[model samples]
Target: MKKIDVIVKYFYPLAAGIEINVRNVYKHMVSHGWDVTIHTSTDMPEAKNSLPVIDHLDGMNIHRYPWRWYGFVPRIDWAHTPAIALHNFNIFPHSWLLIIVLIRRTLGMSSPKVFLTPHGGFTPEWRTFSPLSRFIKKTYQEILGVHLINAAVDGLRSVSDWEAVESIKHGMRPDIIHIIHNGLEREVYTQIEKLANQVTTDQVRKLGRYLIQIGRIHPIKNQATGIKALKHLPQDIQFVIIGPVTDPEYKKSLDLLISQLGLFDRVHFLGVISGVNKYYWLRHSVVNVHMALWESYCNVIHESMSQGCVCIVSRGTALEELIKDKINGFCVPEYDEVSVADAVKYILDSSHARQILAMRKRNTDFTRGHSWQNISLQVEKMYTTALGS
Candidate 1:
């Protein structure tokens, strides 16, 4: 069987949305009789550099190269061209890998068909990036990166319809675009639900009448807005934030805001969690809030819904496709405090609890199509199509 080369910025000892999605899908593919090798960095820019090493996880081969000099450089030795090269997260490693492949092809060497998955990084909303970074990225794309992505890639894999439109706007050929939504491992959720139903964990119950938001603590997550929404709710309503602090300054700002609002006791920040502990909170929280500036498709929303937790997401994101306001879930018009507060208040009010529970019961039926096993089959078909192209 021809092997597929997977290039990502980081793998293992770190958990991000893109990393989780790649891990789950490829692991499924491997089990289904596909050969997948992941080429990734040992650490991200924030972590200390280390020597390169090779590792394997659940039958998937991983080559972890030292990410010295801020993860901007990558060292890869391709003994032979792979059948397909799928690049996730279009940053450093992807750019460098593309350059190397293009150079090899130019020298009459074997070249694998390339696939690009920007993972929501190329949407027009990306124009909101900090001025200095935005200027540098736009200039690079206009001068070289855009052309490389358009001319060299065999296909552009999109996780949502909105993402597909964004890629087309950025010069990728529409014919080569494929929309493959992210998948959920139902078995994982089944196990979690079993644990969550047994008893409310003391740690989660201690927070009392809280709402939860699970993701990185970054400005793009729009967490400050969620904090401000607390003003509109009853004082007893605690707000629990669960995720790794990706940005210290942003966390400080959140802390400062918590102090300013005098919500020291009411607001709680529980750093990164997974497994049964994660599901416990999701299963019990009054609402799961995910109001981000832009998200390709948030896995947490599906996880929360699967656990029978009511979800309130921001409108205009890919999440809009999965949620229906006043039906399966709630969608706020904007990420502002007023909008979020209104959505929360509506769901938390005593009168609405019955309706919310009704929707919760229907969540599993609605999300049955997202099984990761089925999604891997769709990915396999796409791989076949890309190789044929």
Candidate 2:
């Protein structure tokens, strides 16, 4: 069987969005008689011990390489320093592995076609980057990425059209860019059905008639705007934020803002929720408002929509692409509290209950197209095209 080569920084866990994409797409590909070998880095921040160097699961071979967290530079304890005040530059050793594997294939030493998924990595602009970080990003893209890495890749997968456009602005070719959105597995909806009969989680029951956003606590995810919008909302409707605090300094600022706005009581944070419990909150929320300042794609909104949760997202990124501005759901500016408040108000108003129902139906119907099976077919087609047949 022919194989596909996917080179990325992380792959083992089913935690992050990028790995989830690989697992879903390639898992389905295996069912369609294709094999995959994922080349990934070994920097597991959460693991107590190193994961195995090689393993097989779901009929896919995995090769893990040793990787430094900050490459040649020292890893900053992001908790102590403000993110904007610091910067570090480092080379991605994955590029070396990619070039070597691609050359081997070119010399008829290997058969797999090398595919690259940027996975929210190749951005023209960095939302949270420090000054030196921005310079280093440009240097890497112009030197290593454009001249060598892009030339060696058989295909480049961008999760959103917005991501594809930004990558082109940096170094990638438009012709090689494939806009494949992240998708849902059958397991996602099945989990919802099993949990539907059970009582909602205590967190959900405690904050009845609430809005929720699920993503790491960072400036990029823009949880502050959700909190800001609450001042304009009724007292009964609160906001719940779910996810680990990846940015401690940002969380501090959020806490301060929460106190300043007198919204400390209304905004609750449930860190790191998963499986049935996570979906329970999603299902019962008045709406899932994810106004992330930057994203290649918003997987949270996709998952929420799958479980019949209405959403309000920001425009200009893939969030807008998923939501059609009050058609399926609402779209507001990333930081516009008034627009967000208005959208929430519209949803809660007794007059718009019928409208909300129609939106929920449309959202679920739209999400059906993003099934992992269809994503696998598209991915298979990309690999075939790379083979020049």
Best by TM-score: 1
Per-residue accuracy of model 1 over 148-212 as CA lDDT, tens digit each: 77767877778888888877777767987889888776554566645653344776666678888
User: Which is the leading candidate under lDDT?
Assistant: 1
Off by over 4 Å in 1: 44-46, 50-52, 68-79, 84-86, 89-91, 187-193, 196-200
Q: How does residue 12 of candidate 1 score in lDDT?
A: 61
Clashing pairs in 2: none
Instruction: Note the residue pairs that clash in candidate 1.
Output: none
Report lDDT (Cα) of residue 191, candidate 2. 59
